[model samples]
Target: VAAPARRGRALTAAVVVAALVLFAVGGGAGFALTRALAGASLLPPPSAGAPSLPAITDEAPARVTTASAATANGEQGAEFTIEVGADWTSFLEQRANRGLAPSTVVHLVAPTGGYEVSVQRFADYYPRHSVEDYLSLVRSRWPKGQYFGEATDVTDPLDPAAPEPPVQFSYRTVEKATELGRAADAGGRDLRRSRYSRVLPRGADLWVVEVVFPTEQEEMGRSRLFDTIAGTFAVVG
Candidate 1:
């Protein structure tokens, strides 16, 4: 009877040890898997650079600086310069970090009116499209009732002798007053006039400058002001 009792004790001990071994191995595997998943989750997301516009380099991000002088008020960018009225304020458009390229959009706003100018630059490698081609593509995306004026050839402010001349055009569109940040009755819309210019500098990129203001301000001499501002766009580097 004593021998049978000892055998039973040994068997119970063996079973307990086996259960502990299995639990340790399983728990260790689960812990490793959890850590692997956590490490993967900590990884950064893919770059937000536009697929159509590849980044040229991993250099420091580009920035815009306000340049004010008694004779001129303008914004200087990494590759371009644009003159604005003394009351105009400039800011770089916020965009996702693209390690290869700097921000390409800049905005200049008038001090006391709903007038704004935006400048955008695009690389030449990806699309390889001409300025006229880009303008045509843009016009196709305008909303209904858009009135487009005849496009006219304009001298490139940066390179006046470039083989391909820049183009300028004016257009009118109706937009929601709320969209333009103007106070209006419910469902009211406003007529907006805009001038767009496409300049192909003597480089691997092109620029587009747009000026927008309320149509009501045209008679107040805003049109000439907008044109003068847009014409001041030039490539610096």
Candidate 2:
């Protein structure tokens, strides 16, 4: 059986800003209280009679939509909006991928569990080249994964006008996950690498947008949540 996939990238400092948005209303007081509690002695364990925290499950998908502004300029530049589960919130604590253009990024977090997803845009340095070329460049940086499978177009179900476009594909790769600082998990990260990418054509300019998510859905053998979120991805002018 194929091993489960894991998250590959680190959360960038800029992305961390999103995580604080919800907490910003509480101000520094909430942060100060958390720190104070952490410094104090360990609290006693809860009694057996105490209620336990609810288990994290992927059986049902959450309904939440968050819109991000269009990055590429001009009449043909692509713009998009995505919806994540309501249980998931903004995950600001993500590391920046220096290779990508820091135009716009949306990170989502599973409040009840440790799952995250992100959408980011990268400038198309080789506007003259084909979309395949860009996909190859991005894959090259991911040296760890053993990629397998041919690229297939991810078409727009809502728009029949955009037919058989090679802007998206079915990408798969397997790689060791980053567990501890150095210890690598035996499970793979192919599912994580199953991100959806597209090149936005803005006149002569090109921009790439990527939607990334944890393999949590796959881990639970559930796909509804992932599919639900992915359904909202769009590249528009």
TM-score of decoy 2: 0.47
Per-residue accuracy of model 2 over 1-237 as CA lDDT, tens digit each:
233222222345445766777568576667667867889534555544312333445555666454443344452343456666666776432223444333455677667544445665443334445555556666675556366553656544433432223355545555554532333343223234355455544333344444443433343312444445556666554
- What would the TM-scores of all predictions be? 0.52, 0.47
Candidate 1 residue lDDT tens string, 78-144: 4556766555677765333222223266777766546677776654412455666656656666765
TM-score, candidate 1, is 0.52
How close to the true structure is residue 206 of candidate 2, measured as C-alpha lDDT?
A: 41
The 0-to-1 C-alpha lDDT of every candidate, in the order given, reads 0.57, 0.49
Show model 1 residue runs off by greater than 4 Å.
1-77, 94-103, 125-127, 160-163, 177-187, 219-223
lDDT score at residue 210, model 2, on the 0-100 scale: 47
- Candidate 2 whole-model C-alpha lDDT, 0 to 1: 0.49
